[model samples]
Target: MSDNQNLLAGQRRALILDEVRRRGGVRVSELTRMLRVSDMTVRRDLDALARQGMLEKVHGGAVPVPEGRTHEPGFEAKSALETSAKYAIARAAAGFAAPGGAVALSGGTTTYAVAQQLVEVAELTVVTNSVRVADVFHTAPRPAEGGPARPATVVLTGGVRTPSDALVGPVADAAIAALHFDVLFLGVHGLSEGAGLSTPNLAEAETNRHFIRSARRVVLVADHTKWGVTGLSSFAALEQVDVLVTDSGLEPEARRVLAERVPELIIADAEEE
Candidate 1:
């Protein structure tokens, strides 16, 4: 390839990955317009990346590979969602956790909220795969009359890093497998009748499955918006999850579906209080 062609290819490849990260998936038609490249050229670029296992090609677009890693979302965009609901869900989920209990928190914004609420609780050991989640407790202050400090031990899993800052892979899986937690709080991209618990990245799904296997109970913490969207990988079936904690704004139909599928559903109304 000529120097200009090489530069173009590099740029296009970067754009493709960025788009996939941003949208969770992207179609060929969208890329062609965004990158101003011929459909054939875009296909070639996607093919090259797909061969490397960075992405999975679908009919018209590509989805991220399920690995411990993920595409990053803008901080502002992620923070804009049902904030009140997330806080309520966090409080309710945190109530289920006991002091001195061993817990594993999966990566995601909802899980991050859970970590924040956990700071007030004393003598808890938290194992997590999210760099962001670990950081929250790492800087938390100790309680004034504490027998032991608040937010006891925080363990961060080691593995390959994804764009979304998740640590996922064989290393992560092995680490999770070695410990049995009292509860595991998982964050998901989407929940559907057919897909069950799903995420955009296949690698993340694999690592999540390992977490589920290692935990005695599994609680899925997600917002109402995640109810209908379908991602690329299914991490757990509804029956496998012990509890589904979500906001009160959840659609009635979605609640009915979840109640039918999941064993228990906890609806936290942040607005009530």
Candidate 2:
């Protein structure tokens, strides 16, 4: 109401924006402490920013506006963007697989990396649409301590191919409907608190949705850059995922929101490589 009060509110909002920009996300409690503002004040500021299209407001915080989420990159291009981060996430995600159980993998560079790690798995039933991903298991042999190792069974979904090498269409969707998996690993173009799990291709989104339904437990593998981007179509929500394996490049604020919203959060540190 007063001149100084207005100035303080303006300054606090500016700081809030800066913090979210730097960390990709921010929590209300942390913002209150950092900005020395009341709970109501923080919410009001976040709401204002959200209305301005500057950020997306989540359960307890805000994430910076995801840029280029609607843009789909080719497989080769994406694989080169975050090589180290993808490897770390892949390894972490592969640990979730049950040795003899079935697993469904979506198309993406990160998921492909996960599949590569899965080549070591002696026995696994893998269902996927990516040619490269399926090849990893079929071509690579798993060494066994005794006699011959049981080969991993890879079921390829038939459908139209995209720039990212994902198979999608009525065919792919139908294949997913007929089978159930122990776990599903989904890789998306971008993740936003509001949009949930999203991708640039509509057909891929449709196909990925069935993968979510086929598996009782779903895990999302993505790098930090995927946080703010909201793809053109959303396949799953943040709460729908059973586990998330991401790289340490994620901001602390984003990490906090994930820990609060999701059941489990695993940050794959690249230093282990």
**Which model scores highest in TM-score?**
2
Clashing pairs in 2: 66-228
Task: Kindly report which residue pairs in candidate 1 clash with one another.
Answer: 65-202, 66-201, 66-202, 66-203, 67-203, 67-204, 68-168
Q: Whose lDDT is greatest here?
A: 2
lDDT of 1: 0.82
lDDT of 2 by residue, 1-273 (tens): 233244455556666776887788989999877766579989998997777666789999999766574667677646545677899999999988877889989999999999988776657899998887988887885575785455458899999999889899999999999999999988989888888888889999999989998899999999998897888889888998899999999998899888888899999999987
After superposing all C-alphas onto the true structure, candidate 1 shows an RMSD in angstroms of 10.2
State the TM-score for model 1.
Answer: 0.72
Q: What lDDT tens digits, residue by residue, belong to model 1 across residues 66-170?
A: 644244443233543566677889988888788889999998878889999988777899999999889999977656683566877889999987645678999
What are the runs in model 2 whose C-alpha is more than 4 Å off? 1-69, 142-150
